[model samples]
Target: MKAAALLFIICVHLVSGGSHSLQYFYTGVTRGINFPEFTDVGLVDGEQFVYYDSNTRRYVPKVDWIKNNIEPEYWTRVTQIAQGHEANFKANVGIAMQRFNQSGGIHTFQSMYGCEWDDETGATDGYEQYGYDGADFISLDLKSTSYVAPVPQAVITKQKKDGVAAEFMKNYLTQICVDWLKKYVQYGKSSLERKVPPQVSLLQTDPSSPVVCHATGFYPDKVMISWQKDGQDLHEDVDVGETLSNHDGTFQKRAELKVTPVERKKNQFTCLVEHKSGDPIHMILTEEKIRTNSAGNNLPVIIAGLVVAALVLIAVVVMVVKRRSGIHTAHDET
Candidate 1:
């Protein structure tokens, strides 16, 4: 019974068409921000937020914030904060730039407090004012300068770019979904997971004319194709083609479409390929030439053959007439 069950499971996997090799899809916003600098504060304060995935041992953006915001503007600001922290620390290191740049390991300092001008007494007083309380404050005359190791600027720059890019992508994707929902009015949530690649091809009758549009993928349970002209859905003068299976293990699918050259040239035609997953892939074919021609089409070849035969016959007739008229003998003798 156990063996039979194992065999059944294997059969089920084969029949069901197991998942495609796992490929990570990373989409997000990346932004760059200027770091702050400060002088004379004497106290160095630096902070960095390192993101990591405990389960996958990979670094990925925090997803919760992204879904909730659904806007690029918000994520752009978050990236600024993360980058600002790194820049602030670099300024604190001051003269330690060389050492920090060389190796960014931990560096410690002992006597960091220094004797400087008092806020109340000004530069005349040697005592350093330590507190904001009315008159009660501690005073230390001994002055020493210390540098806290700076944050690695390279690291900061990379993080800032990545964060911003990830956020931007997220927002872009969300907007796509919103637009699709507004237009379709029937697709349910969770439709974004089944996205397939877009299709571009030549129209059937006119091989020289190219048709660019989106079609449903191979294995998707449901799919839709739409064309837009001047930002409006085009219903007339557009022919929707059939979908074909890839027969591959994955869910890849394709569909054909036909549109007139006028529509294609106007840039008014867009092929929107949508699956249950998310935003559809939009494709525009600008070129008029078709991508493929049927091998059986023989009109051009037949015309060329007829022209060659006519030229050969004309040459033969001229040669015979010259020979019969004795012109061939005269020409040869000369």
Candidate 2:
């Protein structure tokens, strides 16, 4: 029993100290730091204007709303503001890394300053977060800002001595979040409840094969994509994909089903999409339906082709008649 107890204590000691050794092993080599060089901020009424610098290459006008509505003068001012913010953020990050003695491989640092006011609740909240190497090292909320535990003891000690936590909260609230809110409120009170329905498409690499249903351009992010057979949900042979963000701040996802020949013949398979938008969208699966939709989309092209052919035939007939009439006139004159 005494030997067992000694073994258990030794295990505990190793487990406790082993984690620190592992962390040091992983971050032993010093790597240069690279911070984000751009800023993106926006406001929304019924319309949203998400402004970012075009030079930053992070902003792509994939949504028609941004492409059509962004004013040139507004873009100019936003670009300048983004540049300034980037400079200030990088400078602060540099100072923090130096303070932490970060001479190690690939450490990431992040800072977010946000403010929101709710008209219904009459609550105004501001938040700030500082993360190092993807862990929340310090945080600032509406009430207080403090260093989180589980960080390096050296870091915690330095932060406490320098009063960094309190200063960060003050500067972020007064200098950053407040200023952003003042500008954002002017755009209007556009709640995030607005839902933009996804644009869905069904794809099959081969005829009479497995079907893939793709959904894109949805907003607010909560959505359900399913494969159904004869009004019943399917489990087996169904592969549900993850929802990912689009460049324009929208979301997209896909679901695939490997269907049997018998199910394909019955024409009862469908891809159902559920979103915050009212009713579910149904995309029927069958070769006949695919051909019908294809034909309907091609109707305009078919009509245009027929019209062009008829015009060419008429032109040729007119030219032949004119040539014959000229030959007859020449023959009579001769």
Candidate 3:
């Protein structure tokens, strides 16, 4: 269950597309506590399809396509490889603990490797990087084809390894990984290529709050949100937040623009949203157009109230007709 939750967080770091990707993440913890000492996950196009852990000691498929389409031997080979990586990561974490002169606190060593392919342009890219205690430690520089260690603590380990691993990584990322990505994409093409458009809203809390342009429920995870003033684009004072995943596999993003009423009155303000699912959207920021969370400003409640009033009016009309028909029948009888 934790592995499934991690997939959503990993979406923010992926190379998104019309393209496809194959990524593997491994982590080793200093102390197991309630969690596994070592864990591994594999994702294609931001969706987790396979998972492994020190406790499980097995490579297991998370989706139907793998069980239906992939051979059993693939899991065996992957499990063996992950076991080897688990041992190395554990030892590396201990060594790091010693080097840092820490005796008992929890620490982590993490590694991520992946390849991305642009189906539209036939372009490709690959990456391999490692982190220690949640900060950059070492990475294979694809451009220089050498390892980079950002801090002094990692320099010793960086000096021990040569260019052999980098060369291997280059080959795997460019050729082997991309081939696997294409296959996985084919296996799930029905879902991998489908598009769902975004639902966009412009929101404000009060007269002094920043105006927010929120877009949610978009698929493919690629979008552009920006602010425009009059006929020109406003590049400054706009805070663009990270793209986040929804529980149902869609994506959302927010861009906030801080503007004074004087500035808003002098120029036309607009939020422009672009996504692959549909045509671009331009929402002009007028005071009357922005949805608010102030007292008595809930849109849903307002709409519901209108619906209730209409229903009450219809019920009254029906009752009046019934009463009038009964009176007419009595008078005719008399």
Candidate 4:
């Protein structure tokens, strides 16, 4: 049972699809002077999957994406893996708890099984440790037989010479999880290539302002936005800005190029954006194309002022004409 649980822990780490499938197996056994002693097993599937909290005795999932989109068979296999570890892990913890009580030590026994792998770099590493309190008493590395000190070189050398480490890795880690990973990749294809086409715009704070090429709402993170002079890419007077996140999950970034008042009259600057999903987006920067900061404000303000002035002028002319007519009527009557 120990061997099986250890192999499953290694297999979970070995599974990668453009990202690591980091899973942690945990067990804890605690007993107070008067309280009852109990042990439980836990399994945590990172980020996209579920976590079995031994304390709660329930499986809590991070997202429902797997259940909604993933095939039933795939999830069933994952459930089996979790169930198989439950009893074995509890039994292992019970043994540790018995040992601690026999020694008359008041301590908690905890063990963690972890797998760390880097998908881009193709690095696979994991460790299993059992200890009381916070210090580990037993440690094993699945990668190699180079055991640390206090674990004698003779023992490690003997294990290495016997090829124990190599056999364990091959038989358990490599072969067990191949079928599951194949289906996981298919179900997670959208996550691997999820992208939003960039929305590009050429803008200026004012008519004579520096031209900025902006791109927003893109995914998979990295993008290139640049200022082009005539047909070539401009390097001088270019301020390449950093990409920033939007309120939504996408990202936004802009690159600015200083444009003089004289340069604004010419149709020489163009903004170019490159992203994975679509063809390069291009926008020619011209005086007419540059959007001023107060472009929409000026027209409404001017129109309102003219209407108010016309109303005041009309009122004054009517008052003066009425006064003249009253004077002429009084003169005629006299």
Question: Which one wins on lDDT?
Answer: 3
Candidate 3, position 42, lDDT: 69
Which has the better TM-score: candidate 1, or candidate 2?
A: 2
Model 3 — TM-score against the truth?
0.72
lDDT of 4 by residue, 69-118 (tens): 75566445544444444444445444544544555444433344434444
Residue 36's lDDT within candidate 1 is 16
Best-first order by TM-score: 3, 2, 4, 1
All candidates' lDDT scores? 0.28, 0.44, 0.67, 0.45
TM-score, candidate number 4: 0.38
Question: Across residues 1-334, which tens digit of lDDT does each residue of candidate 2 receive?
Answer: 1111111110000111101000000000112423223334332221224534324633333344444545666555544544554444445444446656854344333333334444444344544344444444444334444433345622543355234445554455444444444434433224334578988777655555566787777765567999888889988899986554454555667787898667688758888999876589998886654422334444344224333322111100000001111001000000
Best by TM-score: 3
- Alpha-carbon RMSD of each model: 35.4, 25.9, 21.6, 29.8
Q: Using Cα atoms with residue i matched to residue i, what is each candidate's TM-score against the true structure?
A: 0.25, 0.46, 0.72, 0.38
Q: How far in Å is the alpha carbon of 217 misplaced in model 2?
A: 2.5
Candidate 2: where are CA atoms >4 Å away? 1-84, 91-108, 115-126, 132-137, 141-145, 157-195, 203-212, 219-222, 226-250, 254-270, 284-334
Show where candidate 4 strays beyond 4 Å.
1-188, 297-334
